[model samples]
Target: MTTATAFDPMSEDYQQNPFGYYRAMRHEAPAYFIESMGVWALFRYEDVVTTLRRPELYSSRDWINNALGEFDPVPQVPSIISSDPPDHARLRRLASKAFVPGLIKKMEPGIRGLISELLDEVQDRSEFDYVSDFAANVPVNVTAQILGADKTIARNEFKRWTADLIRSGARSVLPQEELDRIHRSVNELRGYFTELIAYRRIHPGDDLVSALVQAEEDQQVLSADEVLSLTFIIQFGGAETPSHLISSALWECFGDPALLDAVKTDPDVLPLVIDETFRHVSPVRFLGRTTTQDIELHGKVIPADSVLLSYIASACRDETVFAEPDTFDINRPGLSRHLALGMGPHYCIGAVLGKMMCGLALGMTLQRMPNLRPVADDVTWLPSPWVRGLASYLVAP
Candidate 1:
């Protein structure tokens, strides 16, 4: 008799290093149901990819809100990440209007400057907290600059609000205090974005927010709430993942001397290194989707209305798909094939921007601090079942 493997999202063993647990699920329980969490967990690469590609069968609509058990009293605003079909497409179109390749290219110089400034602040230190001092600052500053919001605002208010909102969203269950904080953050963010949207309406600027304000579809402009929702998603999405990606890349590289040497010597390989990092330590670990109808997989029937957790982190490291799956190889062929940023209609819109930020940050770090290395093996990671990111890493250059 095969004993079922137990999995718990809140367990410290899983939180510390989930890759082993992922491997177990992929091998022994490809479609394991976690009664405690009330979700079906899919870990195999093919299973995750199929579920992501078939959004019609696996819907994202209300998956998060339902999991968190929160509903806004106000009419729901169309959201790019939380909707399906026509609504997702519409919100995506409007949001993409502001993230054109040209605009992202235009921000490159500014992004580089901000990266340099951040490094300059830490240049004199023998040791510094990589996450708080550098990694955390880059994406928030870039998001603020892109949105035409004062960078000062992002440095504090926007950063705190978005961090809390994301933390709250990543949990399987939230205590009353956390739920209250999430509510407050949501209200604060709405007010902040509403004000910015109103300002953009009167005084247009050459920034993402202004572009979003003027963006039209079928001769229809976005409603105030829609605009707010888009900005909220953009800022929140922008801030969290890339920050983690950069720090995680550094952690992986510094832990491997050969990888660190290669990254330091060859700037051209930085993108590849970033890609490998995505596969090895994906910033967003899992995404939730609700089944539209019953589905059979791995000899088990997942009933309709069931919530499925597509473990991207697991898929990226599936031994069936990747050789020596746990090893972090910078030159790994077809690294981009990993589902770190997701797949299909809900694929991350900010993927390109995220890669750019991480690449530049990693490249600049190598250039500025060639001798950079972690001060200790002990690192603090954010306690989120759905997200993977270092909270702090003491590094010395």
Candidate 2:
């Protein structure tokens, strides 16, 4: 008989060393069932790659919300990520029109400037918390400005809300107080976007909300909730993931000296280093979906109505995909395809732009900072089971 895996995810020493546990799962149970959560986790690269691409067959239908009976993964407002089809297509076009290529291109110089400034403040200090002082603030502030919100107000508020939402959702069940708080935040977030949309409608700025409001004026349109949903999605998704990725990437460089030296010396290796970092140290770990019909994989059937969770972080380290699945090799090839931003119809809208942000900010960061290394110990994880990022990485120059 196969001995069962532990029930509580946090019960494992995963926080201390998760990769070793993931590697074991790759062989023992590639398409294993997480008895604790009553959800199935797909660990190997091949399985994850296939599942992410076939949102049609697997059906992102109710899956986007990642539901369990009477429990909702997201709040009431449904964004494109939670949608499939003609609705998904329509919403994408609406959002895409606002998320213009020209706007992203314009963001490049500002990112470089922000990175330089952050590094400067840290230079005088022997040790500094990288995430709090630098990584966490920059992306969200930029996203808020783009989304037509006041950066200062949104920055502090957004960070608290996102972090709280994570802790509340990490469990199979949340307390009533937690549930109440989540709902309260959701209402506030909606109202917050409602006000911003109103402001953009009259004032008209170069930001994304102004662009969406103009789309409405053009006889192209969206509902009040849809507008609010898109705005919330843009600000939260854009801010959370990229900031997590940057801090996590820096942590990888901290542990590996040779990789650090190579990055310090070579400008050409920047892109690959970023790409590999996505694979090695994933920011968002698992996202769930409730399958509408039965599915078969690895000679096992996942019955319909089951909650399927993709171990996105584990997939990146699948031996079948990368040469040294766990190593942070700056020159590693096969950079073209990575699900770090996800895939298919609901692929991350901010992906290209997020990549641009990472390239510019991290590139500029290491360039000016000079001899930057992790301060080691006293670094803190956000206490999020979902986003595997530091609350801060103390840095010393």
Q: Name the best candidate (by TM-score).
A: 1
Residues 59-121 of candidate 1: C-alpha lDDT, one tens digit per residue: 888654754445331237646777898878887887788878998899899889999999999
Q: What does candidate 2's lDDT look like per residue over 118-212, in tens digits?
A: 66777688878777887877777778767768766766688766655555555356777877776666666667778888988789998888887
Colliding pairs, model 2: none
Could you estimate the TM-score for every candidate? 0.94, 0.88
lDDT of each: 0.84, 0.71
* Model 2 alpha-carbon miss at residue 395, Å: 1.6
In angstroms, give how far residue 16 of model 1 lies from its true place: 0.4
